[model samples]
Target: MGAPDFEFRADLLDQSNEIVLVLDPDTGEIVYGNATAMDVLGYDEEDLLGTSITTVTGFDDVESWAEHLPQDEDADHRGENEFVRSDGERIPVEASVSRTTRDGEDYIVVLVRDITERKERESELRRQKERFEQLFETAGTIMVVLDEEGFIERINDRGSKRLGYERGELVGEHWFETVVPDDVEPEVQSIFEGITTGERGGVDGHTNYVETKDGTRRFVQWHNTPIHEGDEVVGILSSGIDITERKRNEDELERYESFVKSAKDVILSIDDDGFFSYVSPASNSVLGYDPDDLRGTSALDYVHPEEKSEAESGLRSTVDGDGDDVTREFRFQRSDGTWIWVEAICTGCRGGGSDDVGIAILRDITERKEYERELAHQRDALEVLNEVVRHDIRNQLQLVTAYAGMLEGDLEGENQEYAATIRESGQNAIEVTRTARDLAATMIADERVASISLRHAVESPLEQVRSAYSDAVFVVDGAIPDVAVAADEMLESVFRNLLQNAVQHNDKAVPRVEISATVDDVATVHVADNGPGVREDMKDDVFGAGETGLKSDSTGLGLYLVNTLVDRYGGTVHVRDNDPDGAIFDIELPLAE
Candidate 1:
């Protein structure tokens, strides 16, 4: 204690710019002041040394400061308050007051700093932030700021207006509570959880009803984003876009799709990868496979072995985008090992995010195919029978005519009546044989299958009928557009037989024949006649091999041959009454590829 630690005292105040003052704690009197303390307060060292610290820079409220100060000498303390300077100016300051002992002398050390500029800048920043909040509150779209807990911390003016609520009503409430419909709560919650967990960044295309304060609901599409602070999520930001009209349209589309899927016809979609992406449940009853089993499986796998090559070629054409529509008649394998005949129509185009997809629809034609086979067999048998009948009947009829000629020359009186009867009977027999040969040849040749144009096939036979019946007016109505037909020969036979029967069997004063063609998903040929309609009792027998009208003397095989040929061509033949009392025959045939 020889130098009284003068050097230690200098070192203590030399390193820091803070104003340091030593005071007598018990009397609140100033005992010493540092160089910085004098400069900061505009005071001289001698002026502060003798005066009490409170007298030089008095606390704004001495009674309050005195009461807040710690009473115990053993504890340290800190506080903030204003002080009046020598000039009588008020300044906010933070004072750290600590009780200390130096050389066994009890005293208090006060460290102080002026915070006037800092406080001014803080107040300016708060004003600017308030301005920004005011601008956000006046926007048009519903804007919401949410904390990490999904609570609505702030909402814009438009949001409040649309929701029919005041701004305060929304703050502190869950953002989802006002927007999410009760029916969609589960879905909205799941999406929210996903966003919160960082599983999804944003979600669009969700349409839900939002309930307003007025108890009305409106459809809206929400766009959401996760708010991140550095690497951590702090909250979410959401914008609502009203889409009530769009939602209604979407609902209508879904309803239409549902109806199509439930239709009796099988509706399906095949991808460019040659796989069935969508197959209706009706496929189970039609194709012998569960709809689930067919999905992602190649549709070509079900094609019959014999028809696989053709089906594959058609599929390739579709995949290459070379054909818009390609149709083929093939057999499809059933679960029972047997094959069912089918006519498939394939339409090629881009699908499923790629251009390599193909789609096809198949219709079962097993019954039509079976009928065709039976008709072909019957036609062949009838041809052989006709050849024998023509040979024997012609020979017998020629002998009877020759004998009738000789008897006419040798007879007189009563014998003449017998000769006349024999001669007429022989002539009738010859005519019957001729008609039978013509009908048999038509049936046999018509059984073979070949592709031809519908217009040409139907018009050619109609031309012949028009030529044969000069007195009967023949009018071909409706345009017979070009179409592909598998069995041209048989269909031609059917058309010719129908036209001839109409002309020959009609009792109308002016016999008229109408032949028309209609092309659609399938091609149809309609042949009608202005004739006394077929008797109801004879309609069923008209298609029989040997059935003929009670009034007609012809070999009654015309309608029978028409039905046979129609069936051989994988088509149907049905009878109907024409408008003005006549027979109408309707035939439907598959289109050519």
Candidate 2:
């Protein structure tokens, strides 16, 4: 075919946009070329005429070109290959070829299209796939790609190592059966099925446990995404991190919080700036303040005015690490604006990447403080009473006795007898004053009960009573017990009062008194007198403050003092009828160790 013979069809062939070519299938020679072919291939009519088709198309030779052509008449074939331009640059092109017989000559028709943009898109997609594969294989955390059937299609090195398996050991395995714990396998399989079917969305940061090869469970936080092919989800891609240690720490923190909630004392924390940071639930019960009321407020604001300076100093020492730990007492103001004594133990603490904090445990001691104050007041009042009784009262009674003795010496008959009676009464008044002073001193003592020898306590008071009542016959029925009793220095006062009561209230012309003691778990002292026996009805109140037996004017402090001292020492005293005709005063005291 020559250019001049093709002039009539050139107008129709040139109107098409494609590079149209006519070739002789047997010789692989270009029979005709259109205007589009000349323009796209960058060739002229003289350069393309009689040119072999292999010169421009990506075909090795005439046979290869004929092999791609349709073997049957009117049948077309489509293929892609690069086209070599005049400048030697290759651009991808798609070609459709068919064989036809025109004017009874066998020839091939070819339509060529530029596919450079489409090829560029395909190349970009290939590059992106390669990048994704690289990232999936080398990621720092566990990465797994699962097929729609929940099979492990691929797993990264990190995922294999975390599950305690060698590389490639877990591939092609069912994900739930191989790694998911038995307890959670059912739930995990259900979720996986939902994701693959697009019934459920991808899960992000979902926490669960996975079983390792060694049968131990590790807590995992996972992120999952659905792999979509067009509009259908074909698989799931998952990434996860091992959070086992973090879960353990969270459990321990929860236990400590439980302890703080149930504690009896107030537990609180303050920051380095002396502001409250955390307060436990116990604060409401111990300090009458809710936890929220104290947080972010200055702790010193609750201290009593007189104790604020000391409390602030102690807080500073703890937060600054100067003292680290200190226990001090301060009066803290309650929510109701009342001050209460509290003993606070503050200790310094430090946390990661934060300022120092001070932890304080506060115990209320208001009752103890009040008891101490009452004791001190009692001591002061007792001291003043002791001064008045020991000096002024005893001195006045002494002068009355001296004047009555003088008058008895100068008088006669009934008048002198009356003077003698007045002198004896004055002497008794002086003795009563002595007993009252001893009782007052005992009441004010810090410890009114102590271990004292029972024999020593009984002997001194017995001798004193024997001298005062020379007319009375005092006998010891048995040896005094050489044991200790729980009584104070006032123990002697107890026996003295009993011995004098035995002799003074006797109705017999000569009073007979007997003292004996029997030791068992406790020391029992018995003082018996041959006096008018006490009535059974009055036995309980005989030790009343003013119940002097047979004498209304007498100050009945002796037996009353005995009762008070015995009771304070955790002992018992009672009066009963003696074996013959008198009263027996029995004193029972605990034996001190």
Candidate 3:
């Protein structure tokens, strides 16, 4: 019997890896330990067997442990306690203290489990939850929780700050009191009733206005979801985002779109597939197509066949993402099958995704195009007639005048006088023919860039004036600069006509013609004469074709040709009163580089 009891005690020690202390029921003292306990406390089993557990545990709660000790010396008290390790570190432990009879002596048996790692994990989880709650409370959006009956249960810091209320003051208040205006109460009540009765879906994304504590209105977009307890609705969780500025911008954009649709000019957009996506209401008057008819139809289909290739090329360029601006004129077939000219200006438009689109504005130019065509035809006809008269007819007239002069030189006496009269008549005819040829030449020649020196161009007409009026005083004022001009022959014709008109119209005994040239950035020639100035009533008509100041049979083409040629060179010619009471003709021409 004694050997069996000793073996049982050894087996109990081997089964536990903890420090087992069998203490006296009325006193605290250590009794035994396993090998693991002795190794953990940095002591040999023999040395720890008789030592108190408090010496290794370093616990100051000895009295509490004594009170919870087994009263009948047979029960156990389960508790968690702390112990100091051999390295002087505190460790959390769970202990079960029970009374046992060993050799008829009352003692305690204690079981312990280290729980330090478990406690550390619990602390880390607590800190993480606190961080998330802080983020939620400080978010920019207004967050609120409502009971199933739409009563406000809780509001975050942002919500209370926006509503001008203390965090605690808003709780238990009715949600609709703050959000729904009195005028819109019926509609709002219907919405909440639907939510509570489960008729309409919970307001996930609804935009409405809310009133602040100060009675000012605010626009908010609510995103609410039902907080469910099992299958039944318990409450609603809502997050509101302030969108007042965004709503205002949307309203302005809607007004702008309306204005664009009602504009007089056609505004349109085409997708990458070349189909019209948008067309303004003006399409009815401009393109002969209804606005709806243009949608889904290729805009290029209505273009004239001759212009289709160019229009397609531009469209393809836009689809390929080319950056060039597109501007082209094309003929579009109207509803009546008649073609009307349209000028289209297109720009490439790119959206968030897909291929590039094309935005275009089209304008009708049918009347302008028709006028241009008629003007071109008239110009071509006039050019051909002028060419024939100047080149062919004038050569024959020059030959007739030359033969008459030779015949007059051959004859003598009475026959010579008669031949002299014939020669004079022929000469007069030649002068008329020359003037006609010059006028025709002026009308036919291309008015493109033709540079001529100013001095050389003016000498020919000045010599003619000196020869014709030998007694008249003709002064070429100072040394004229060599001015390069685009229309040299036209300038010569202009000066010649003015000088002749000055000499012929003057009733003065000594007719004086002063020709002066002045040049700065632009070239100007002034021809002043001691002749009567143009009449006020005739001034406006002086530049008109076939208008003349002289009552005599002057063709009046001289001043008209001068005005026409000056305009062709982008120059100006006007008559002004001379400084000393004479007629002054001022001609301005651009200086050629």
Candidate 4:
């Protein structure tokens, strides 16, 4: 080429957007570089001119680059490789090489293009694929990708392990044929078809059973989405979790709810504000109110006016979660506005939620309360009768005995005997009245148990009986043990009645009685009398109501009261025939703790 022609071509190449380089084929040196080449390579013309091609290209030498070039001079050679910049940074580039003859001289022409953005795009695609694979395999739930024809394209590690299969065993297998049971295959296939045909988008929370390799089935909850290529649906991606255990828990909860609904007691829950949060269906039968009607209403509204304060206080402690279980009885209004007694047991829970709630179980106690009321009335009436006998009857009997005694001294012969009989009968009647008074006092007493000294209990009654029966002899076998027993003021009456019975019923002229007591785990007292021995069959019936021992005309209230009081103190009393003659009354009482 002429110099003008070479200058024109060189100037034209410099103006081109491409990075152009002219090289010496044999030397592998850059003969010329365009302006674009200098700017992209980060170098000036002086820094690049005459530089060896190996400095910029990855090739080691001229012969190495020649081997990759096209052998035909007319053909162009293309390559994708990196170029080292002046600043020592390497960037990817595309290169084209061709050999041409100018004025019979061989020369090489090379064109280069920067491809950093394109290479970055490729790298980003690889990174996104890796991230997707990591998420798909490591997910907790089963994930699967299926083709439009229902073939398994991909199954995650979790899905394969859950189905008892190796990593790639499920790939390329028909999903329904391999995993779905025969009974539900047709139905599942229909849904899959809808997804692929665009008739339905996908499934959300659809449940079905999947058979494993061992033929055991597991119920799964599925959520699926369609995978689209352009405007056409190509496949489906599904996620599933085993819901068998959750279903069983739900069934148990349902059964428990049914039981609560049919229970006879009213069950309810209360919030922190003392209002009812939930009420069981049994409220209708138990409290004469509908469950819905009771909900959201204050529980204290139905309580009796006198009991509202106690009810409110209990509610506060329970909802605050600071109190133990509480059981209390109070009057509650029925649906008809009449009051009925109810017993409520309430409990609380801590850390349950924002407002820790309380639960109450209420039962009707109206029948028991009514029975208690009737007993109170009967006791009051008996108390009035007891006062009448204690004063009126005893005073009248005393006057009759005094008048008969006066008559006895004045009369003679058979008249004197008649006066003595009248005096004795009046005295016996007076003693009977005292026994009756003791019985009445025992029956009406509340809180009837206390710790009593055995020694005092026996000594006081012994002295009284000895003074009353001057003709009878009373002796203590040994000193009475000074032990505390579980008894009350009525305890003295027990020994008094026994001592009186021993003397009054004696057939001997001089009645001899011996009292003794021993203490171990309990206090046992024995009262032995030297009298006609009681029959074995009558011993048990002696304490029965109206069944007197040795005296049929007398009321057996004294002996009966002895049995009742002993029982109240957690003790027992029994009569047995003494050795040779008379009877022994044995009383065993618990020791006071």
User: Which scores greater on TM-score, model 2 or model 3?
Assistant: 2
- Which residue segments of model 2 deviate by more than 4 Å? 3-20, 25-52, 58-79, 86-88, 96-98, 113-118, 229-232, 254-266, 279-297, 367-593
Model 2, span 1-593: residue lDDT tens: 43325577789999888888888887877778888888888889788868898989868888888778899786999989888888888889999998877776778888898888889999998999999889888888899999999899989998999999986789999888898988888778887888888998898988899998999899999999999999999999999989999999999989988898889989888898998888888778778999999999998998988888999889888888765588889998889988889999999887766664778999998998999899788888888989988998889889999999999999999999999999989878877887899889877776646789999999998998899788999999989988888888889999988888887788889999999999998899999998997998889899998887754345789989999989989999999998789999999999997
Q: How many residue pairs in model 1 have overlapping backbones?
A: 4
TM-score of 2: 0.58
Error of 4 at 37 (Å): 37
Which residue runs does candidate 1 get wrong by more than 4 Å? 1-260, 263-273, 351-356, 385-392, 434-593
Residue 305, candidate 2: C-alpha displacement in angstroms: 3.3
lDDT of 4 by residue, 500-524 (tens): 8888778888999999999888899
Regions more than 4 Å wrong, model 4: 1-263, 304-330, 347-351, 354-356
Winner of 2 and 3 under lDDT? 2
Give residue 232's error in model 3 in angstroms: 34
Alpha carbon deviation, residue 13, candidate 2 (Å): 7.9
Residue pairs with colliding backbones in model 1 are 137-157, 272-356, 272-357, 484-592
Off by over 4 Å in 3: 1-259, 262-264, 352-356, 399-452, 464-473, 485-489, 508-511, 568-570, 579-581
lDDT of 2: 0.87
Q: State in Å the error of residue 222, model 4.
A: 14
Of the two candidates 1 and 2, the one with more favorable TM-score, higher being better, is 2
| Residue 115, model 1, lDDT | 71
- Tell me each candidate's TM-score: 0.43, 0.58, 0.54, 0.58
